[model samples]
Target: MPTTPAQPPVFTQKKLPLLRTEELMLNMGPQHPSTHGVLKVVLELEGERIMKATPVMGFLHRGVEKLAEDGTYHQFIPHTDRLDYVCAMYNNFAYVRAVEKLLDLKVPERSEYLRTIVAEVQRIIGHLFWLGTQALDIGAMTVFFYTFREREFLLDWFDQLCGARLTTSWYRIGGVERDVSQDLIGQLRYFMKEFPPKIDEYNVLLEKNRIWIARTKGIAIISAEDALSFGLSGPTLRGSGVEYDLRKAEPYGAYDQVEWSVPIGVNGDTYDRYWIRIEELKESSKIITQCLDKLPEGPIMADVPQIVAPTKDRVFTNLESMIMQFKFFSVGFPMPKGEIYCGTEAHKGELGFYIVSNGEGKPYRLKIRAPSFIHMGAFDHMSRGYMIADVVTIFGTYDIVMGECDR
Candidate 1:
């Protein structure tokens, strides 16, 4: 009976296994709206936070470099238009400047000033396009319309300057395709006068908007060292406070003759890049104005008979000039057996061309240092730890165009 006495029940707690989670893989583009082009990004995400990003390029690859090898130097100017098609003039300018360096050609003084003016106009157009599209991406709709409104004017001016608006092959190897008429100059001067306030209007819409500030500030930050290491140029590099601009550093065109300052940012974030571009719009306007006021009177094309095309009047009137034109376009000019790399300050970044010549018309080897492609190299580095939503902003911040990226 004592042994059978009831004993208190004993209790034990059971341990549960820890929950295991798997990361997610997301294909953001090649079709998605925000990729900026036929760009595909493989994002490894953990609950809406991006862990890694891999850019899948070549969707728009047209083997542009190979094409450069197949054609004459003069024939390739239009091809450069297809790369960064949004800002074709800069591409043309960069490519021609590279070819000129290889040929050791000297552009006329008037041609230099003209090239600078048109280039700055192209710069403003580029910045406007960037601002509009970028603001639209960030949920600010009004800014888009405003920026594009001004952009339309410049594009129309482009049409007047060169028959084409988007893919204008207005740049020549030693100079420009044609001189800027007085009427175009007058219109551009008017645009310069009106463009500053319009930039302010864009700022008014997003500069103080709480949502835009929250979205852009403290996002996608890169230091000056990293920027340089990554070979970032233009506003992207300047946003990191690096004051290296080919226009000023190398003094190409009339950049040295102009009195304008490069904008530097204290914090290398999306906001800083945006701010830098905004300031650049103003500086571009100032540059255009000065270049116009001091526009010299001379021939637009270099006097290199072999490389430069003869004037239309001469081509029509003189039998020898007609034959020369035909030969220049057909067989192309002979280049010395050498290699050269020339970097130009394009809208997106440093648009460089490294060409190897074999005493032939076509390039033996051609390489393009496209900013969109180079900037993509740093995408995974910059996008780590940011939210998935921030990817679009990062893309716009780079002002990426896949036309050049995949090429």
Candidate 2:
């Protein structure tokens, strides 16, 4: 729909050929800060309004799926950590779930509960990251600093659980690698109680601020039907008044046992998406609180010694244990030859992993469905008729991260 004067008109005038219209084509990114990553939006503008916005991607392509084919089953967990680097835990859970389903393995009850707790905590942290960065994108710098301060505590907790902070490949195919201590649970409980006050602080900063409301109110509206048609899930779908959440619909990892509500927005506008995440943070915090209280006592890993590592004492003392460990390390468990898709509600939207295994340790094919990619596809539809300044607000409100978009 974009027309530029530099190019010949679609329909030429016979007598008044001298007449012309002025429209400009602009490149916004591939290297701009507001994009949230290396995303390039080619905008054809008619003065201050965007006529068409075509998003160009692939700047951050790491060939993750290709890399998966070459790595061992255990080795590939770290690679998933790199995809949605902000919320690697969810990525880890999604991928492992797909692989586990293919293997038809059931994790221990305690491990499932722990996985739920860690994942929900990470979900809260991921939303906090989005809240802060999106606020900063729209020119509220104080919220960024405030949110990061809280994130630091969560990262510290992650470090305490696993040695690694960012890429905690703590999730194994059948279960978690190890158990969390009571002290860590206590720290998490303290965090859950304190986090709501921090969320309140964020709300005070911008929730009712006149400028924030004006910037967001009716910008970048996605209709419920269109959102559903586009396969929009997670907060994006919820923002459009759909109450479908993967945790509730396809209850994996003890999510069925916990009680939580899927928050929806009536308008599906930029403001609604923002509010959906804000409300989700509250809900995720509550889930974490319930999980912490219900933390059970049992073996963290399922007793599938062929798939999981043996006890440290057994491995150190017995020759049979050494051989089993060697077999587990060298020849990975033969997974069922089938394909399965597992999706979870990531910070953005539906993050899904489609995995095909061929009775080998490595997967035959792995494909990731990144929510940012689909959401970004609707940019032109969302941004048309909005002012150039409102374009920034719309992009920030959608919270599209190029890491997943380009993946």
Quick one: best TM-score, which candidate? Answer: 1
Overall lDDT per candidate, in order of appearance: 0.88, 0.82
lDDT of 2 by residue, 1-407 (tens): 11111111132225456767567888988787788888888888776777888888899988888998877677788888888788888888888887777778899989999999989878887888888887887788999999999899999999999887888998988899778988999999998888898888999998898888878777777788888887877787787788888888888998888888888787877778888888988998888888777878887887877678777799999999988877777776677888888887777778898988887977788899998888887888878777778767766776677777777
Q: How accurate is candidate 2 locally (lDDT)?
A: 0.82
lDDT per residue, candidate 1, 96-117, as tens digits? 9999999999999998998888
**Winner by lDDT:** 1
Error of 2 at 293 (Å): 1.1
Clashing pairs in 2: none
**Alpha-carbon error at 308 in model 2, in Å?**
1.3
List the candidates' TM-scores in order: 0.94, 0.92
The Cα error of candidate 1 at residue 87, in Å, is 0.3
Cα lDDT for residue 389, model 1?
Answer: 89
Off by over 4 Å in 2: 1-20
